[model samples]
Target: MDGDLRGWRQCLLSGAVFAVCMAGTTLPTPLYGLYQEKFDFSELTVTVVYAVYAVGVIGVLLLAGNASDAVGRRPVLLWGLGAATASAVCFLFATTLGWLYVGRLLSGLSAGLFTGAATAYVMELAPHGGTSRATFLATAANMGGLGCGPLLAGVLAQYADWPLYLPFAVHLALVACSAAVLLRLPETVRERRPLRTVRPQRPGLPPRVRSVFGPAAAATFVGFALFGVFTSVSPSFLAHSLDVRNHAVSGLIVALAFFASTAGQLAVGRFGLGRSLPLGCAALLGGLALLAGALWWDLLPLVVLSALVGGIGHGLAFRGSLAVVAAASEANQRAAVISALFVVAYAGISVPVIGVGLLAGPMGLEGAGLVFIACMMLLVSTAGVYLLRRPAPAAETAGQP
Candidate 1:
């Protein structure tokens, strides 16, 4: 009993650390307007700055995604915390657009490293038979931390004295404390390797895993596409179309989607993975519809509803996809396979967002969003149909080893 309590405590501590690192990524979400005012840039610049973080995440996932498996979780997470701190410091001292880009990229690197490592670390730290609860802890920390970022920043930026400076300073202090906490936690990996020995990761899939990977990756791509659009451009949409300019409200709206997603993820176990994927896709399709209505009519309530509903769909579909893929993958190849899954997910975040940015000038933000929704809707709907036609093979249904 004592050992079990100790293990749960460690897992919870790890989740907290993961949340702190992730919070830095979106800390600047609410402050983008402020940066624009100070630097005199366009909306395209904001999307580009946000997209840089995706690029950094994709780069890290491609190059060193398996570093934790090789060198141990604590060291990699410590490095992630360092990157996060650097990102915060960059935001604190930013006087140019370049600084924002640099900060976002570093933040992305921090997230890329933490995403897989921290997820695995949290699960591994759990006592035997506690996998289900640990999964929730890790995922809730991830999405909740992301939700908290804009909320924390928006509140601080809205009411606090140093709008930009205070948030990053707070995050920096949190990162330092996270580092200390991590130092005290026991290392999960038994055999650790030197950082130099970690080789560049190639994006590949073995023949055995390819069958399950296709549809799983597709669902993940669409889920993240939904999130990408919401996080990157929803605030601009809210401010311009609806004429709602409150930073706190905008942040909360975005946060609602992520929070709703946590709820959606929780439903996966109840619905079962096979059913959750298609059901999630159906919900996502509904969300896209709600988003379209909001865009067309310029209704604030519709937008909020779209965020909450769509976020739930995203959560359901994303966690279901992750579970499907993780369960199907071979023990030794799990990290690499998961990295490939994230590559698709991150692409959704980057490419569609840039497309929206490009089209914003010609078509306007509403039209661009509609176009994005239409495209993602088609993609997700197709995946849902496919999953329904042929459920994941029986071989792929087992949980991760």
Candidate 2:
């Protein structure tokens, strides 16, 4: 029908906007080293900067995660775009370490707002019975945009002039264009409310969801931790250890993990949740092992393999975790439960990375990475064994792809 076609078009357009906003979050990933050179900061400062973004994300998720449901998606998303624009501007004119932190925090706020609101918007814009494909579009847009961030920055930083300034400049333009597209798209929320109605949601789990939440949250944590490590520190490792100072190469290495995660997410429907969770765990374990090998032997091949394999594991486990948790929750409690999972995942991103940074001072990057890997490996293995013993219940029936 004509309506279906229109819905799909809108959905795609919204997804593009979503992607652009997310890309800005990672635009600075490849340029951290350049900032370090200019600012003369330590690696510990780098991880702290990265973790600050997670702090922003977590803060938003807890305080205003349901803002779109109250005030409508467009307003919240427009605010997200504004935050992203501020972030880009901060990066463009960054002179001190404080500027980078502020930029990263704003970037995180943009992502935190977009993550749930944009996803819900994309799905709502889809025609009836299009949930499955829309879910893929939203998730792909998320991870794909994240992948594009580093790649775009790295290429521009390597071959183009104004390495630090140009990327954010381009992102600012993209954000402006995205804002235009968003304005034209129809609002999905029918029940408009004042911002006063939006209440802060504390993370909570219903009794039913608690059983499945344990292993699922664990897998999600480890998966995100892997990503956290890759995005935050892998570039430094490549530059210092391998003497691979090419910005494009470092960006590509980080981007590969996110791209691979998107690919892995696409495969989950075929395997189903029951199988995917365990397989995801196994893959995560493999990724951690590959990273260990890369650290120990200083092998570039292993590093690449670790990104591919670990990315897949992250995708599989993350998606599967979402499905399993959704299946176990009562409908009214679903959003809060999902927020709890995200809290855990983002915590994984922040906590472990800061730990690595702390240890990096004494143990060196390689030793710190190995220690981090060893800890994540044990966690993933435990989750894997638990999933095998007790498969998640009713995921195929209740959860959407």
Candidate 3:
């Protein structure tokens, strides 16, 4: 009983650290407009800054995706925390557009290191028979932490003084606390190897797994794309289109999607993975339609509903996809497979957002957003129809256990 208690405590601590690290990545969500005013740049520049983080994340995932497996989780996590702290410091002192790019890039590197390593670390810290609970811990820490970022920043920016500086300062303090918590936890990896053993991450999968990977990756991509647009550019849309310029309101609106996603993920276990994927895609399609309505009519309520409902779809599909792929992968290759899945997911978030930025100047925010929604809607609808026509194999369904 005592041992079990210790393990649970350790898992909780690890999850908290995971949340803190992930929060840094999105801490600037509500503050982008301020940067735009300060630096006098175009919307294209904003998306480019956001995309830079994705590039950093993809770069790390390709080069050192499995670094923690060799060097021990704690070492990699410590470095992630250190990077997060540095990122906060960058934001605190940011004066020009270049500083924003550097801060975002460092934030992405921190998230890249944390995503796989922290999830594995939380699971490893769990006691036997705790895998199911630990999975929730990992997912919640990831999505929940993301939700908190905008909320924290928005509230601080709205109510407190020094909107930009306070948020980063608070994040820096949270990083310090998380680092201290990590020091108290025991190291999970027993045979830690040198960094030289870490090889470049080449995408690898057996022929059998490819069938499930296709639809799963599609759903993950569309879901992340929705979130990407919401976090990066939706504030400008709300302000310029609907005339809602309140920073706290803007932050809360973006945060709503992430919070709804957490709720949606919880629903997946009750709904069953096989059924949830297509259902989620359908919800996503509806969300896209609602978003189009918002764009065309300039309806604030429609935008809010679209964010909430669409976020739920993203959560349901994302967690279902993770379970499906993880079930199909062998234990030895699971880490690599999961890393590949995230590469696809983050690409969804990064590429489409950049496209929106590029088109914003010519088409305007609403026009660019409508184009994005149309494309994502088509992609998600096709995936849903494919899943409905040919359901996931019985073998794959059974593999989920």
Candidate 4:
């Protein structure tokens, strides 16, 4: 039985659950500086710590990405929420740097569990003819929740007591409430089987979709890589170089990028998938330039501008990638192709960030950031050229909403 959930009520409830779980993944974003001070670690260590979360996400996606499809969405989701609560507990009691890594890994597990499962759950709960709106709800929940995590933590850390402890405590309360709300919602996955039966589905790409996948994936990789740098290292830059020690302000800057991305995703429907990809690439290049300028001149304003522009570009490219790849893919093969692209994207988030950290020690943070910008600029530019030369096939986007 499909959990009998229908109408807007169920849709919103599912979205709320998505938001809460996603928020937990980023709750520690603004607090990395505090962690660094307490642990007395290098920038490289900070990036490695952050990258560990992506590792957890990738691991879960590889291992149990389809668990909900097999065991039912509600059950898998309950387990995800449990993992998230445990992550918060880890953070609440974190007395050393090792706890942070463990907490991050657990948070990644929660996100990995929720990402595909929650997306499908929200979509399934929607009424007929509501796919576009449902897509918006899920996207917003994801980006909005990510943006909120740092903002909430920054505020509490700056103004309230227990900078390290309060944020996770608050998140714990929310996760508990979200779980309660979730239990009331209907399970959307029918014909469920035992979780043991689920296997790791190998990621695949159809030959026909290859051309479009190449350029689209390139864009996603750059966007995620840029975000990785910002979230992992920008706060330290602001505090050390710009003398902007306010945690709240640092969090706000990081939050702006995500909010801007949400806005960009919304605008993609107007641009059409074919145009959005190339346009997004161009915008991304411009953003990289702005970021480079920020690093070169050490201008805080430039950094802010870069976040806004880059985030918008990221939004456009990300949504465009989703549409183009989905349109190009055979209906049956869509999930695997999308999964492959995400693997590339998450690689962007982890690998290059660690590279930046490695370079940071020898080249310095600004120099390392400049190097990152240059490399990503080349990647995005190449993608832009490819997209321009070969626009999305008409057949692919013809059916796109």
- The C-alpha lDDT values of all candidates are 0.87, 0.93, 0.89, 0.88
TM values, all candidates: 0.95, 0.98, 0.96, 0.96
List model 4 lDDT by residue over 245-346, tens digit each.
899999989888888899889888787766787888988898899999988888999999998999999999998898788888889998898888888888
Clashing pairs in 4: none
Candidate 2: segments with Cα more than 4 A from true spot: 394-401
lDDT of 1 by residue, 1-401 (tens): 99999999999999999999888888888788788899998878888999899998999888888899989999899999999999998999998899999999999999999998999999999999999899999999999999999989888887879998999999999999999999999999999888888888876687887877887777788778888888888888877778878888988988898899999999887787767777888888899999999999989988889888888888888887777777777788876787788889899888888889898989998989899889988888888888888788732364223
Candidate 1 segments whose C-alpha is farther than 4 A from its true place: 207-211, 394-401
Error of 2 at 165 (Å): 0.3
Give candidate 4 misplaced runs (Cα > 4 Å).
Answer: 1-6, 394-401
Residue-level error in angstroms, candidate 3, position 392: 2.0
lDDT of 2 by residue, 1-401 (tens): 99999999999999999999999998888888899899998888999999999999999999999999989999999999999999999999998999999999999999999999999999999999999899999999999999999999999999999999999999999999999999999999999999999899999998888878999899999999999999999889999998889999999999999999999999997887767888999999999999999999999999999999999999999988988888788888988999999999999998999999999999999999999999999999999998888877745554444
lDDT of 3 by residue, 1-401 (tens): 99999999999999999998988898899899988888899999889898888887888898888899999999999999988998898899998888899998999999889988999999999999999899889989998899889888988998999998999999999999999999989999999999999998876676767888888899899999999999999989888888888889988988889888988988987788777788889888888898999999999999899989999999888887877777788887776787788899999999999999999999999999999999999899888998888877732474364
Please identify model 3 stretches exceeding 4 Å from their true place: 330-333, 394-401
Count clashes in each candidate, considering only residues at least 3 apart in sequence or on different chains. 0, 0, 0, 0
Candidate with top TM-score is 2
For model 3, give the 10-residue run with minimal summed lDDT: 392-401
